[model samples]
Target: MTTVTSRPASAASMAWAGRASGVWLRLSVTAALLAAAGNIYALSDLEGIYGRETSAFVNQAIAQDAVDLAVVSPAIAVLAFLARRGSLRAYLTWLGAVAFMTYNYVIYTLSVHVGPLFLVWVAVLGLSAFSLIGGLAALDGQAVAARFDRAPRRPAGWLLVIVAALFTMLWLKDIVPATLAGRLPQSVSELALPSSPVHVLDLSFFLPAAFISGALLLRGRPWAYTTAPGLLAFLALTGLPIMVTPFVAQTRGDEPAWAVLPPIVGIVIACLAVLAGLMRPLPRATGTPVKVPVSRTDRRHPPHQDAAA
Candidate 1:
């Protein structure tokens, strides 16, 4: 009985791997550029670009500044991963990606609601974009077998969907009326909430994120990598806006209720993205097995080829 051995890697497999590596490299470069841009913008004294609260996070410890640290830390970690190998790099890259994404979401929300603050947006976008870039950069020469099995297998995914949808429906009930009421020029001081559709759609985007994050953690992705940024990002983008509206109105001596989702789900999605990255499958060894090498004399001397030997 002959045992079949695996064959060497094929041209197609090599080509695919090359392409994947290239993509990761490009992503890393993008992340680095964005991070640099963010740093520059943060330094600029542009009005409506930096909020007092947001500025604190960004400018904290200029040498050890949190925003700079958070954004750059991941890139460094990603670089380390690329220079090295094994699960450690994978873990670091994954965590960095999560942090970057979460930061991105928060900055995105603030920029949209508070003001342009394009600098903050650029910074956050850079963090996320760079994280992805860094992540891909580190993946250069690495082979990953992409898998479609990241989606949760249990009923929990579905259950959360239903619950989130309901919350969205409830949240919407409060929002639409408020939005309509607030639309009036005289409505500045009136308490109003978001529309139902907004709540539902927001929830729809949010819950999946939470579910993804949770799943990633359970599947053993790092906390920082799987959960932090996504949760923070979602909260900043979706949760904070609603909370801020009332404060904004109150600061102006008015009262208004802006709709906000609980954000339980958004947290999950961020976590999942990290986990999914870590758990990404390695390339399956495919192709027919080739026989192991044997001595030419042995092959020629075989019962079937005695004359040839």
Candidate 2:
């Protein structure tokens, strides 16, 4: 019989992760700046910018831009700065912010019409995507999991599962029936978008991520600890835009999705609560050592060397 041992990450891999961290930090900061610029322009009354998009979609876009400018962009910069110091909690939060930007602009890049800020949108999208990828690459999942060894996984896991299910049902209720009936969902038609970017993105990526993260969390897997917080952050950020879109629509004299906003607000609050729960038990500064200051008496003489005193 041959025996094999699991080895810790090699110095080379660790060094690579360090380099990746630096790369992502720079990329995320650039993405944040670009997102801020792009969002400002989107929120502005730039002539022909929104361009033939339905009022509903444009109003939602305004809401998203507002949130991105006021919340997401600043979050990315601040969290990335903190993550650079190498805390797992900070890294997860930073990753979540990048994911929100990346996910958001994917919808913006595809849905919004071509205009002056198109390249800026594309640039932010690309930077955010790479930052998200690099941030994930830099994670040491097992090490991250170890810090949350005392976290209440079961409740948090179930909470994530419930949130995932709620969103799944929310989308699929519109999609599944419409698909079977061979007709477009009302939202798609109403919005006049070439396609349903939210549906496509959610079904293809975000929802699945939620389901996987939730399932793994239930199993108490090491990777789940690393994923759940970031997922929660994305949900929280995503929900904010959704929650505000209705109000934005109302303010603009469009018919607001008032019924949905309350539920969305609830979901956002749930995400935050679970995020705090998951993060509560984590030891601060994952790999960093804490220093204790020596008192003058201790500095002057060691306890075992009484004669020296």
Per-model lDDT: 0.38, 0.73
Question: lDDT of model 2 at residue 25?
Answer: 78
Write the residue-wise lDDT of candidate 2 on 1-309 in tens digits: 111122221221232234344767788899899889878876776356786688888888888989999999998888766555444466677788889999988988898888888899899999999988977865656555555656677766787788778778988898888879998888798888656999899888888888888888888687787778888899899888888888888888988888987778887888888788777733332244322233343335322211100
Badly placed stretches (over 4 Å) of model 1 are: 1-17, 36-48, 51-152, 155-174, 182-309
Q: After superposition, how far is residue 266 of candidate 1 from its true place, in Å?
A: 11
lDDT tens string, model 1, 99-153?
4444444534442335444555555555555545444343212122111122232
Work out the TM-score per prediction.
0.38, 0.84
Per-residue error (Å), model 2, residue 174: 0.8
lDDT value for model 1? 0.38
